[model samples]
Target: MNNLLQINSTDVTVFVFAGIIVLALLFGFIMYFLFSYRHKQKDFQLLHDQKQQIDVQKIELEKTLRELKSTQAQLIQQEKMANLGELTAGVAHEIQNPLNFVNNFSEVSNELIEELKTERQKTESERSAGTENDIINDIEQNLQKINYHGKRAESIVKGMLQHSRANAGVKEPTDINKLADEYLRLSFHGLRAKDKSFNADFKTDFDESIGKINVIPQDIGRVLLNLFNNAFYTVNEKRKSASDSYLPTVLVQTKKLNSAIEIIVRDNGDGIPKKIIEKIFQPFFTTKPTGQGTGLGLSLSYDIIKAHSGEIKVESKEGEGTTFIIQLPIL
Candidate 1:
């Protein structure tokens, strides 16, 4: 009986240990599954957040693309307007000649008519009275007025025809100084047409030794015109509120440096800001308010000079003035 009891007791202890181990293993498995599920949930949340971020970025990119397209369309429209302005200016220049002829001829014709009427009245009176002196004096006076007016009308027509033709096809070795002078006059005339009291003090310093340059006369003339226009615009703005003693001025000068010729256009108007100085040569960069500037004049001028193997540079100080220096190869 004792031996049987001892064996039963040992068996019960082994059974108890086995139950404890099985319960511990079950708890461990449950804990592992809970941790694994939590880890999966965290990973899923991270992926969901990543997708949301990607969606937001896509939306921003689409918005940016739309903005770019809109800006490009506006630039295209501005370019078209600029081209139209150039065409209009050219046409206006052509029409001025004929208009000038019409004006001059009309004045002369009116004066001649008046003189003829006076002579007819005098002749009628003299013939009725049989007075020889009155007839002779009337004939002399009428002839003088007719001759004067006829010559005046002819002169006007000739001038008008001459102005109508292109005056700059001939590319001869022209003195740079003289070409500059002519452009200066034309530029001033253009400004005066727009504003009668817009005169600014103009000065020039030409290097006599620079001599002639090989360039298309019209092209150079146009370049000078652009420069003069900018200068006048700047000076005019400053002189709007300036005292008579503070009259604005522009200085144009030329110098020969080694194998290159340098021309400078300087103005005492409000200078360009530093942040934009580098961007001034870029197409469509303008300091002037909208509708006041086309912004292509300088860019086109820059391209023309570059095609001639030249360079343009600027030096400016805010509130003082700005200077544009153009350097061209002497050869």
Candidate 2:
């Protein structure tokens, strides 16, 4: 009985020891599992925060880009208005001459009518048939003069309206020669009206065979006006310091190529300096005195030409003269 009791005690102790070891291993595994789960959760939360930050930055960048585009549009419009302002005075002056002619001819024709009625009222013995015929001829001539002047005024008004209106961005067949000539005269008159002493002799040599070309008239006209105005400006400036023998002249020439049409605006004045010539087409670049220029004319012209699938380049010498050549595709 004593031996049996001793064996039973030994078996109970061994079983207790085995149970303790199993419990300790299970507790250590549970702790490791909790720590690994918490570490994974922290990494996932950091990634989510970074994703949210990137989204916010993207939204802010888009908003900034939109604002920048709006600002650029406003500046471009302002430049167009500034150019139109220069053309206005010239349009007014150009219109006035035709108006005066129309008014004078109308008045003369009225007088002729009164004289005709008077002649008709006269007795056959008092009125000579030859005198009646002469009066009628004079009246016919006056009417013709009135008609011609009326048409002239109409054309000038059309041009003013065309220049003032916003570009519709539509391409149409346009008489390039006429367009160039018109702007050249308009620019010349504009300068003259501003400064009574400003004078420049301008000439045109156009290739009549080029015919009408497909282009955005308003945009091309704006380009020509800018160049003509600049040419006149340079010549006028040179005139101020030039000797008595100096003659300020501007010449516009056009030609036809196999696949393109070329327009040349040449001036005899203080040519652009070679150092700054390459920068002329860049935005906000100008040699004009402050407040006298916006520095956007050439930049805009460059853009316009490029939009039309054309090229514009300049050749200049410091003291001799400058020439701008533009070549537009046949399309």
Estimate, for each residue in 1-331, the C-alpha lDDT of model 1 and write its tens digit.
7656445777888999999999999999999999998999899989999989999999999999999778755653454344334334333443455455555655655665665566567855454433444555555665665566556555434433332334323445757777677566556655766577787888999999999987655556556667877887888888887777766888889999999888898999888899998888777788889987767667767876787788988899988888989887877
Model 1 residue 279 CA deviation in Å:
1.0
Residue 168 shift from truth in candidate 1, angstroms: 13
- At residue 295, candidate 1 shows an lDDT of 76
Off by over 4 Å in 1: 1-172
- Per-model TM values vs. the true structure: 0.52, 0.83
Clashes of each: 0, 0
TM-score for candidate 2, please give it: 0.83
lDDT of 2 by residue, 120-152 (tens): 999989998888899899989988988898898
